[model samples]
Target: MTAPVSRRSGGRAARKAIREAPLTDDVRPIRPGMEGGRYKPLSQEQVEQIHEAALKALETIGLADAPDSGVAYLTGAGAAQGDDGRIRFPRSVVEDALAKACKKITLHGRDPKNDLELWGSRVHYGTAGAAVHMVDVNGREYRDSTVQDLHDAARICDQLDNIHFVQRPMVCRDIADNREMDLNTIYACCSGTTKHIGTSFTEPDYVPPALEMLHMIAGGEEAWRARPFVSNSNCFVVPPMKFATEACQVMENCIEGGMPVLLLSAGMAGATTPSTIAGAIVQATAECLAGLVYVNAVKPGHPAIFGTWPFGLDLRSGAMTGGSGEQALLSAGCAQMHKHYGLPGGAVGGITDAKLPDMQAGWEAMCSNVMAGLAGLNMVYESAGMHASLLGFCHESLILGDDLIGHAMRCVRGIEVNDVTLALDQIAEVCMGGPGHYLGTDQTLLRMQSDYVYPSLGNRMSPKEWSENDKPDLIENTIARKERILSERSAARFDPLLDAEIRRKFNIHLPA
Candidate 1:
């Protein structure tokens, strides 16, 4: 009996060792494109009501200030243009556009492995925004963001398992010209990560040059078209039923250039959009639906993301409250609208009104991120590292957000209930005096890796253990991890010759 017990203990130790070992991408407990939509903020009837309101808004209110090309595109697609120059979509026209719009899209990465399948409740989280400042948490100061900052952010994002894509998160304040800034933004983000990138063009002409750079990186126009790794985060609307004319033109160029477009409608609640949450959803939905019509009209079946990003406002101070519970509901509600239309969608989440990565930032970030994932947002943009109501980006917080998003994704993965997961046989064996506990059981050993996610920076030790270890500061530890990652050579950098060619072609501001 003693010999049997010793052998059993040895088996348990071996299993523990295996479980503690690093896992490959295939076996990691949480990954990109995990299914969500488990949390529905709106009922079926409510969803339909919002849809009807949006359609009604489009037909009645319509949108103003479309560029001439956009006007041609919409008018040609059965929409009517008013004397005031607003494009009004008849119900049938909007429905037709919806029917023709691509339901699923693959935002490819330079490396095929990072491609994101956007359909149904499949969720992917990543960085987004054009923050002007970089948060120096240790110094408690904010400074202008530079091209190097953008590149470093992408490099950090490439290593993080939970951040699924790299959207241009900060403006390159180092570059004065808008064209050069836009060009450098593309070059910096693409050079640091092979993950699907998202960027914006300052002008229609900028699109051609940016696409030329992308073509050079992709080896040719055909290759770039085959796997256009970057997407355009085009804010096509000026909110309250108006179009951003220049942005619309930029969107047209992007469509012609073979890039996916995120039709962003960012109306602030109580400001640009209606104050009521439901009303805000209606306005944003209406705007994005109009964008859908525009995209389909320009070229039927163009891949477009229904980006309905309505922000929350503090009625008292009249400031944007990105981390508020109202913001979470707004994002989740928009996600449900996306599902109702059966379209690929993106929404904002994990943004912190807090200025730093403190206790407030943690709760603020977690609340919306978990809710967004649970609500099945296809692309949860700004899901990490945003601060000061989206004015600042932080490297330390970005690293910490990787751990935060990992936990949120596990929640999104939810509980798996099957015969095997029920574990009736294992339970019976344990109850029948077979070790009296299941920790050392074969089922326990087999499921450990698949059933759990472990955080890299999060401390889970007991108080005594923590004290023994000198009570490691979370921020300090995160800084150390960030340093270590930056210290290593990035695998995502372009080849030497390719890098030289790109430098020769453009006034690349980033240091080699």
Candidate 2:
């Protein structure tokens, strides 16, 4: 009896060691581009109704304020410009544009291993925002975000497995000139991470210089075009059926430069868009369809994401409520519309109205993130680190979000109900004249890493164990991890000579 007990205990110890070991990408329980169309906020009929409404909107109300070039592009592609200068798309023209659009796109990373295949219900989560302030969670204070903050965010993202891509999250307040800011944003992000990056240009004139920098980074113009790792997050349209003229010009420049475009239309509900949920979705869809038409008109089959980011609002105070349930529904519904068109799409999620990475922030971020993934959003942007309704970004929150998104992705992975998963053989073996429990079973040990996900910073110890181990605070642990990452030599940095040349050519604000 003593010998049997000792053998069982040793087996348990061996199993624990195996369970704690690091897992390879192939065997990891969750990964980028996991399939997640399991939840549908809009029914089939509702989706069709919304689509029809959007088409009607484009045909009648149309969009105003197209720039001279945009007017030419749209009119040249069968759109009618009335005396009011609004471009109206006929059903046939919109359909043609849809038919010509690229059905699938690959967002290449500088390292080929991080490439994201965007199509269908496959989901990938990443960061995106334009917050001007950074949240110092420890001090409970907010301050102007700098270029170094942006670079550090990217470096932290580089080490996180769950953050699939890094979009420019904050303004570089340290840089005074808009052109220099745009260039440095690109340089700071690219130099910190090999993942696919998304950024915006302040002016159409800024595009050429930015592309020149990208060419240098990619070795040449031809090489840059072949594997363009950067995408322009272009807010091509103003809300309520209108084109932002300069933004449109920026979109055209990015297209001419062979970069993928995220045709973002971010309309605040109860203000820019309609108060009702369905109404907001309809407006966002119409605007994005118009954008698709514009993209195809400029260059047929151009890669563009259907970005319908309709945010939520607090009707009582008329303030943005990015963490609300209505916001989740908006993102999920837009995702359904993207699926309806068979196009790669993106929407905002994991935003928090709370000022810090506190309890409110946790619930808010997790709620939308899970819903967004469940709805199968191809690119879930702003999926972490946003706070104070997009006014602030927190580095600790971004680090913690890696663990949060991992759990969300696991939920997105859902259940696998195969014969092996049924475990009838294992069950029978356990009950038939064997130990009362299956704690040290071969099946349990073998499936430990593949079938489960474990959080890195989230504590799961009991009170007794917690006290015995010296209780750890979540934020404290996160800060320690953040320090560890920044202290290490980053693998994501550019080659030394190449970095020196880039610094010489551009006024990069972040130190080498």
Candidate 3:
């Protein structure tokens, strides 16, 4: 179903005349940060049980490999360290931290209008992945993703109405040096889009230099701190109860640098986590809750996203199947738990195991994207462009996924039932006095732009019309759309002088 397209007249003419418009400053019927907790995969009792189980796990099994500073902070905040070096949190500590956790956070964009207020079950979809290979549409093959590719992807996302934020989707395989890669990733994303960007750091030290670049972009350290446009996607924990030592340190630095932290716990079900969906949620919740306590211990009420991102594994082949129904349920269940705690949280969705953006990719992407929004996930990560279980990123697929997410957000918006929406008067007038059909109604025209969302790349033609139009393929259309967007659109969102200064100071590989 498409968003309500404006009609010039009736039937075919209206359909044909529905032009694909540019992204405007006007608010859409379905927009970013819409509340969406309509679907509940887990019951209240089930949520309570999972919460209890997670608390029990933290109290009993505990977590291992806490760095010395982490040990100090956690212990000082009511965590106990055993002789075996496992740091265990008492239930009170966990509860205290949960109470202290920031419930509402504004992930600011350099442009103030793009800021995302993450609170409750407000839904937002965006790009995110760590794909090593880029899906070359012209060549129909995978190639090393470069910094330029990342920048281009960001530029594409800036024009996509459905994509709310641009996270680092693919790694820069061109940059071998880890520090250079980290810094360039930040620069490319910032220079490409004004939307809030999400990126990862190699180590705690890499953050300071990256912050310097961010400071330059924001004009000063104070301005950057006041409206930090980028967040650290820190995977602070290894699955099954252990801290990633370096990642935890990196999280600390990000918290200190006035950057928001995504306390991510990505455990693959049936492998790193339990096979059952509830068990996986329990483990992920426990890990991220522990992360919450760690963050609170460092600084109370710090803005940290409760990222419980657990993927599904095809047990038969031991391969990651991000597109599976189980993965969708897992994400929905995790979102439920996040809501139970009243914390701003994130989950993965719209990932595809398909090698290409075919019918299989469409079904897979739509299924999870719809489910994730309905479940009210605050940040729907990897909601576009990921393919082959996230080994590759496709620009064409990303563009198509925007249309898919547009429909999904429409689902999240659901139906509005009110006095005007009841429309009994209109129905009476149409049936009794008016011409048999409501085709040329004033209400229809008035509500057209406000009530509906139209896809730029989606085809709405009849079979004969489609044949007459030369049977345009969706992929080809998406490819043309991508080319048009990249060629016609501005790749550089930053000022030319600022970009030049950035290039002059840093070893920036992306062309100006």
Best by lDDT: 2
Residues 1-512, model 1: lDDT tens digits: 55456775588578658857878877788989999999999999999999999999999889999998988989999899988788999999999999999999999999999999999999999999899999998899999999999999999999998999999999999999999999999999998999999999999999999999999999999999999999999999998999999999999999999999999999999999999999999999999999999999888999999999999999999999999999999999999999999999999999999999999999999999999999999999999999999999999999999999999999999998999999899889988878788775778767778889878899987899799999999999999999998998778889999999999999999998
TM-score of each: 0.97, 0.98, 0.96
Task: Judging by lDDT, tell me the better candidate of 2 and 3.
Answer: 2
In candidate 3, what are the lDDT values of residues 1-512, reduced to their tens digit? 87776554455465446433343546366789988999999989999999999999999999999899999999999999999999999999999999999999999987887899999889999999889999987787999999989988998988887899998999999999999999999988987888999999987899999999999999999999899999999999999899999999998998999999999999999999999999999999999999999999999999999999999999999999999999999999999999999999999999999988889999999999999999999999999999999999999998989999989999998999999989898999999978877765888766766678877778887899799999999888888888887886464467779878888888998776
For every candidate, C-alpha RMSD to the true structure in Å: 2.4, 1.8, 3.8
Q: lDDT (0-100) at residue 130 of candidate 3?
A: 86
Better of 1 and 3 by lDDT: 1
How many clashing pairs in candidate 2?
A: 0
Among the numbered candidates, top TM-score falls to: 2
Give the C-alpha lDDT of model 1: 0.94
